[model samples]
Target: MEEYQKLSLIDPQRVANLPTPDKLFLFLSCTGSIEYPGTERAVRIVGEKLGIEFIESVDQTCCTGYMLTCNAVNPQLALASTSRNLSIPQEMGLDVGVFCNGCYGYLRELAHLLHSNPAFKEVGDKANQALGREKFHGHTKIYHVQELWFRQLEKLTSLVKRPLTGLKIAAHYGCHYLANKDVAIDDAQYPTFHEEIYKALGATPVVYKERRACCGYSVGRGFTHREETVLPHITNKMLSAATAGVQLMTTTCPGCNTALDREQKTITARGNAVSIPVIDLSQLIAFALGAPVEQLGFKANTTPVLPVLERFIK
Candidate 1:
């Protein structure tokens, strides 16, 4: 078994380029789009608030990481396929921003491989040549939306109309975002982005054990491990959050949300109950930015967060 490497992503001091780029191509994810729609809505709403030019391509296809992780496809095939998918926006010279952690990791890792390995680049080149699209010149920059928000924390702070006031939130940093610690996202050991956002919105951030533990949906769902190993880990997370008195929980990955939110009943069935609502970091941002709760799609949630609504909703 490959040991999960512990990592911490440092908070970026500034937006890579301020005043926002004119255009950003979004590589939306399946889990985020359908299971945690509020995250998508939050990204759109935050982009609007920041005056960012955002573009979406329905013609674009999946990164296929989900299937790849399940060993359903060859790694080489996954690399070549991702290279083709990434080339779409590079041809348009648009910087890429993804809301999903899986997309962020797959796209960045695949792009890095294509850029550094001549053999891999050749495979990607031949594959794209067959498609007749321009070669992916490696001109594109990839960013997770958290980078944008952290860079523009001041702007985010100014937009808060309904301060979170005394509401305690626990930050759930999924494994993928900081998997490569040298990349340094937001202090993985004492992550501040999610907590900072909660603080800026006027909520208190809570810390607890296993704050960095895997949400257990990564490679366990397809196997019985989800019932045996995964559920226990998730149960621990819930107990920690519940005991800490956190009113809400937030994460950047949809897989984490799906595991924590959709599996709440299973966790409860194991003789553990979690009262705090699980939400995406994006959903919390949308609320702070004054978006209507109904528009944010809370109904899609298996775990109702309605009680916390009165705190943020005007």
Candidate 2:
């Protein structure tokens, strides 16, 4: 690549003189809806509160990462799907923002693969060409809404009507998000941004031993190793949270929320009867921004967020 060409591709500000994406092209994962509906509402409410625009496309499809991880589809198929989905917003000049760690990591990795390997690029290119759409040149960037919220923390702080007073909350940064630690906004081993986010919303952020631990279900690992690995892993993680006096746990990924929340109800059967409600970070922000309780869709949680509602939702 020529010097100017290389600079244009890497520089967000210089490339095409493109204005930084202000309107988030929100990408909701399957888990975001079927498992945790609050993520959708939370993103909308949080976007409204932050004065940031959010746009959704029906043409957008699942990131297909979960299927790839589960061995349902080969990496080639996943790459093709990503190329097509990413090409949609790339043509519209919008950056993609995902509410699931799986999608963010999955797409980012695929995009990286396409850029680094001519072989993968050819596969994606052929797929895009066959579909008769713009070629997927890996032109678009992917982000998590957590990063967006962190960027607009002050504005988020200003909108908090119901301060989460004395609500001891713990942050679960999923394995995929932490995978890119060197490029992360905070230390991956001990990130304080989520805790800072808690203070911004007037809540106490708890620190625990398993704060950075995996949920044991990444990429269908739970299905393969649930009995031997997943259960014991979650049990220990939850025990640490309960020990730290954490009342609620917040997740940026809906998949993480599903594992953490659903697993809480069965901790007792495993010999320790401890439970803490797990919710999406977006829902917490929405509640703080004064979105109606019904809009949060907390009913999707099996662990029951009622205690949280009873405490804060007056």
Candidate 3:
């Protein structure tokens, strides 16, 4: 089989492009909007601190990604729909910055398809032709804001008014970010985006067995596999955090948030004692950036970061 063929059916280009100056079209995933609204708040605050302009688009729809994952939507329709969705950001002439891992994965997948798949490209081209407007040139770069933060590591470190120096955290890099080998993100074997970010913010990153395990968000939660597969998978991740004395666990996926956060209580109810906080990456970033604790959405969390908040205040 060919190398690209070995990647997931969807592939995202890992190429780097120049940064553009315009209002960044922030793409919101369904889970991110309602469940983790604080994450949206964090992204905006961080962007403001960095002087990065951004705009949110309500015209965009759900990446409809969950449907595509469960074999509900065909690739052709998914691809075209995603192309239209991405065009919203392109209108701003700025590269899109995605906070949700699912949106990142889906947008990146389509970007790769437009570049590599003639069929997808043709469909998109036809649609653009019909509108007689600019088509997706596939020039826009897709990024997880975490990547931008990584680029500004030194500046971020300087601006960290409240460093999480002694806070032990487990960084969860959700699967969608690196399932495809071609778009292979940061050594999938031992990805470290979250860990590196934690370290830069002055915290220790804990590596655990469930570091790479699926959160069972889309499937396990929707189905009756919570106890059998979901719990075990989540338990493995949390137990590692607990054993390592990690005070908190962070995730980039809302679905992962759903699994890790909501399930933490269930784990405790089962006689397993855990004191760790499950937080979104944005929450952690916001916390590090010295945003007020209330703004970080700690209140919405199941495994609250109150202790962590107490430390920041002190």
Candidate 4:
């Protein structure tokens, strides 16, 4: 076995060997679908430009990892949900590519747990048995869409119809994406892969103090701790980005996109006067690759992205 594949024996779902996937079972996020459909559109657009086929299955349901993380759902049910969703891709002989960090992290973590631990394997077996379909064999590999983009960096660079020259962009890796350190592409403490991607698009990537900070909306924290925690936490993060002169912030997760994009208005309302537009990394890639602004769905964002769009896209 190759060194990377050997290292991934413990967690096969997070194999380090980056394959050029021509077709992928695109794992859809409920939050991304409802709140920011544009990100999904951007993913499709980018995929098209890259000549990759993304398969969306209606049979694939929510990963339920969100509710599981929120402590609102039973553990077995969450495992079962993950098993069912993963089975769809596995049955189709395609690896899973997720756009949201929540889906990416949860699916990988849960799948790893189900396969590695005999106790959880029992749970997965039972869950599959109950459904009366193919048992969860843990064959499907889970990957974040960003990894795929990084894998195709050369092709992506070639497809950049609108280079993001002189635009200052910052990256928010999101907590969930970094949570699985063993499977991540770069160091958790100091990642620069996204910055490298920005450079590929001819944009100046800014590294701010709080670029790696949690978006404060995970696991229902936005609702439970808005005033006491979420607001102040987000406020500080945005201020740090503003201090770094970030024109646009890109997130790997739609949940982080929602938190960072929506909370800016809240921060501004409270007199902080910080308004940095946030968008999905895929959406930004789509924009740079000549996808139309209307197709990107910037209108749904609370913080207007017109200034950033007008500055670079025109």
Candidate 5:
């Protein structure tokens, strides 16, 4: 149950007790940027509050991870594209910090594979060559921003703009991010930093039955099995959280947000779903940090943020 026990997903060299870089390249996943703009805006706002500078890239595109996992594309193609994205951070001389759980998982997994396996690295390198880009060398370390925030609990607590004293917040850590135990904020089996994140901002973290359950977005369940698989799975998750009196659920993955927040309408129409609102962890942090309500872009949420915002937004 220690770093040594977990498969070495994070670069061992980067594992020593080193100060987290104040400036990091924030890799905005496709969903986090366009589909759910609040995540990007809120991340920027929260970064400002933490006094951390975020560097972005116009050349960067989707992590191409969704397809990679779904087997729509070969690992070579996935690795090649991921290399180009990682290169942007490497050239800037900073580690990559991702907000989306999907991006974090794909980028980290791709980087680790390329770094440790010469054959995979060669495939990625050739793919990069075809695009007239530098070969995939896996030079930069990848991290989820949540990991940074998790380590700064005291700092976050010190900067609370509006305490969510009576709020019942549920922590949806999602699946992929935690699967990589070596890199996640805490034990993937029983993550606590998320609950801690909620508590630090003065909200009560709800402990629900499916707190550790998969949102069923990954592994092609969404497309291959929605009603038969994804819907029922997610519905049960919602059932437990709502039954526990959850007001809003916070997630690290946009995919999970789509499954848990958007699908509630479907479940509700069928007469058996909870209308619990879902938002990215960053938006919640931005809210607690007093980022302007308009800036957080809660209106983008499928489930109304007003249910929770009305409590604090004034």
Candidate 6:
């Protein structure tokens, strides 16, 4: 058995088949870029530190998976757009690294459909016919940035200068990453890789009751059902985290970051005292790895992360 395989019997898929690529086509997330630009900046710093080069292309566009998730766009259009965006990385002969769970899950599923389903392959063919030069052959593998971090945990730990020695951090895996259980890197129901990463950084990983619950923002629930369902759902999740004494929270998805970070104000307004600062897992990793705080872009976060930073970041 491989060394990584021996680490976990439950989620061997996480480390057994994990790719440690030196170069990747970094798929930019619309939410991450617009809402938390620090995610990209932090990812770049981590990549540089880890000796991985992140490549970006202007030809790539939004994955269009969000629209499909919201039931707002035609399936054909979403597939075509995904195919087009994927083709850019395939042509460059590089796999994709996505920072958002939504992008990772959506691209992975759509690409699977294109490769496995003849009906979806037909749609991909039509999309290729429409595009003059590029073609998506479903050759590019999509990975969440957190998986990459796990793959390089040893090296990442070695590079940590600002260790989170006394902080209590919780992981929000988000729903999309494991929606397709067959392709997931960790156990869908009870993942511990995030906690493992926390340990690597010397931080105490807090386990809360609602750790596996959905962020309530997926599929447009935050917008369509904020008052009735979303607020209460997130309130419960936050209350559980707060009870667990989670001083900081990390997410693999920017949309979830937006929901967890921004909704705390609303939760406080509704008489819940939950205010755990939420950030991208990549940003936290970069912070621990000694990346400058100014580049991490905490300014855009709705819930101020300064208090959490002061706890560990010197």
10 residues in a row with least lDDT, candidate 2:
1-10
Q: What lDDT would candidate 1 get against the real structure?
A: 0.77
Please write out the lDDT profile of model 5 over residues 152-222, one tens digit for every residue: 66788899988999898888888778888765545677766677778889888777877888887764444
lDDT of each: 0.77, 0.78, 0.72, 0.83, 0.78, 0.84
Model 1 pairs whose backbones collide: 9-184, 9-185, 9-186, 9-187, 10-184, 10-185, 10-186, 164-201
Candidate 1 lDDT, 1-314, residue by residue in tens:
11122333444443345336657998888889988787898888988888877898766787767656866546777766777878888877788988878888888888888888888888888888998966776657888887777777788899987788888788888877677465645555566667666778888788766677778887584334558777887888788777767778888888888888877888887778776688888888888778888878888888888788675676
What is the clash count for each candidate, in the order shown?
A: 8, 0, 0, 0, 0, 0
Residue range 1-314, candidate 4, lDDT tens digits: 00111121122243347778789899999889788999999999998888879998998888776668656446887887888888888888999989998898889988998888888778877877788868788879888888888878889999998999989888998877777887787667766778878889999888787877888886345446446678888989999988888899999988888888887887898999987889999999999999989999999999988787796666
Query: Which candidate should be chosen as best, given lDDT against the real structure?
Result: 6
TM-score for predicted model 5 compared with the true structure? 0.90
TM-score of model number 3: 0.86
Q: Estimate each model's TM-score.
A: 0.91, 0.89, 0.86, 0.91, 0.90, 0.93
Q: Give lDDT for model 5.
A: 0.78
What residue pairs clash in candidate 5, if any at all?
none
Error (Å) of candidate 6 at residue 160 is 0.6
Candidate 6 wrong stretches, greater than 4 Å:
1-10, 219-221
lDDT (tens digit, per residue) of candidate 6 on 85-199: 8888888999999999889888888898888888887887788777774667787888888888888889999999988988989889998887768877777877788988988
Report each candidate's C-alpha RMSD, comma-separated, in the order given.
4.4, 7.7, 6.1, 5.7, 4.7, 3.9
* Comparison by TM-score, 1 against 2, better one: 1
Residue 232 Cα positional deviation in candidate 2, in Å, after optimal superposition: 1.8
lDDT of 3 by residue, 1-314 (tens): 10111222211233233243335778877887687788888888887777778787777777757656765446766666677777777777767888888888887887788878888888877766675646777878777776666555566778888888888788777877766556544666666666767888888776665566677786576445458767776777788767766778887878788778888888888878676777878778778888987787777878777977686775
